[model samples]
Target: AQTVTQSQPEMSVQEAETVTLSCTYDTSESDYYLFWYKQPPSRQMILVIRQEAYKQQNATENRFSVNFQKAAKSFSLKISDSQLGDAAMYFCAYRGFYGGSQGNLIFGKGTKLSVKP
Candidate 1:
């Protein structure tokens, strides 16, 4: 069984500042993918970043980056220079590259991030 957990239900970050959202997962499989997804009030699930389990380097996209600790089963997202547009519900997710549930994504409850100016 694989599961993702977001310890924080909500987070706040001041404009132009940085914020980190914590996520941890339990997975017995070694070949998998970890992702951070953002869903705004508009209800769109945007892919913030992704990391392959076999990769040693953390994944990054623009203002978003991840601190991936494979051995610890921890994957955290760091948002730099926060903006109002960054306010949204962020979800930590996982998917096995090969397995019965390979086509499905297991997601966390989500962390609502509020950006304050």
Candidate 2:
């Protein structure tokens, strides 16, 4: 069984500043994928970034990057140059990549991020 956990229920970041959201997961499978998705007020799940369990390097997308520690089963998101539009409900998700997998995404409860000007 795999589960994602976001210890912080909410986070705040000043405009133009940076914030890091923590996420951890427990999975016995060696091959899998981790992702960060942002759902804004409009209720759209936007893909922030993703990391392959086999990849040693962390994944980055523009101002959003992830610190992926495979051995520790930790994947955290760092948002740089935070803007008002960055405010949203961020979720940490996990997916099994092996064969016969259901391809279901296990998501965390989510961390609500608010940007302050």
Candidate 3:
């Protein structure tokens, strides 16, 4: 079974500062997908970014990127130029490319982010 673990329960970053959330996974499959989703108070899951297993280059959005270490089985999200809008519950998820039964994004418990003014 593939599992993801997020050690930090919560984190806070000052406005305009950067924060890196830690994540690690245990998966046997060499090719898979990793994702970071954000959920605000409304509880809507939003994709922050994703990295395909074959890609050595980490994925980066406007203000988000990931540090993916395939050998170590670790993937972490880094948020830059943080804003109050970035404050939310961040989830690290793993997806098995072709799981016959279900297509699910297995999620870590999550790390709540707070942006302080």
| Candidate that would win on TM-score | 1
lDDT: worst 10-residue window of model 2: 97-106
In candidate 2, clashing pairs total 0
Model 1 accuracy (lDDT, Cα):
0.95
Clashing pairs in 3: none
In angstroms, the error of model 1 at 86 is 0.0
Q: TM-score for all predictions?
A: 0.97, 0.96, 0.96
Which is the better candidate, 2 or 3, if ranked by lDDT? Answer: 2
> Per-residue alpha-carbon lDDT of model 3 for 37-107, expressed as tens digits?
99999989999999998999999999999999999999999999999999999999999888774258899
Candidate 1 lDDT over residue span 31-50, tens digit each: 89999999999999999999
* Residue runs of model 3 more than 4 Å from their true location after superposition: none
Find the 10 residues in a row with the least total lDDT in model 3: 96-105
| lDDT scores of the candidates, listed in order | 0.95, 0.95, 0.94
Question: How far is 61's C-alpha from truth in model 3 (Å)?
Answer: 0.5
The true-versus-predicted C-alpha distance at residue 6 of model 1, in Å, is 0.3
Residue 54, model 1: lDDT of 95
TM-score of model 2 vs. true structure = 0.96
Each prediction's RMSD over C-alphas, in Å, is 0.8, 1.0, 1.0
